[model samples]
Target: MQGSYKDKEGEEFWEEIHEVSTNFTLFLIFLHIVGVTMSSRLHNENLVKSMVTGKKNLNN
Candidate 1:
């Protein structure tokens, strides 16, 4: 986190970027979880299992 004082008005800029990026990442993760839940329920399929197995049963 150490940076020169000239790095855009001291470390405040970096701190702001870090905070926004972290919050954005967490938001994306939350959206992904909600998406997966809705998709699994709608499709009536084990999406996580298919992800781990790398394939899904086409018959279904």
Candidate 2:
């Protein structure tokens, strides 16, 4: 891999790969954060509804 990047073309290809990987990693991280936040919000909402109604709503 080190030797392959000695040429201009290979270097360009490697840079593109790096950029793509970085973007993909950031996207995954963003998805994970969004999932966690949504789950937490749902849990809190359920808790609040349960407290108000004095019963758990599990139908949905």
Listed in order, each prediction's TM-score against the native is 0.75, 0.63
Q: Candidate 1: what lDDT?
A: 0.88
RMSD of each: 3.9, 7.9
* Candidate 1 weakest ten by summed lDDT: 1-10
lDDT of each: 0.88, 0.78
The per-residue C-alpha lDDT of model 1 at residue 24 equals 100
Off by over 4 Å in 2: 1-6, 45-60
The C-alpha stretches of model 1 lying farther than 4 A from their native spots are: 1-9
| Model 1 lDDT at residue 16 | 90
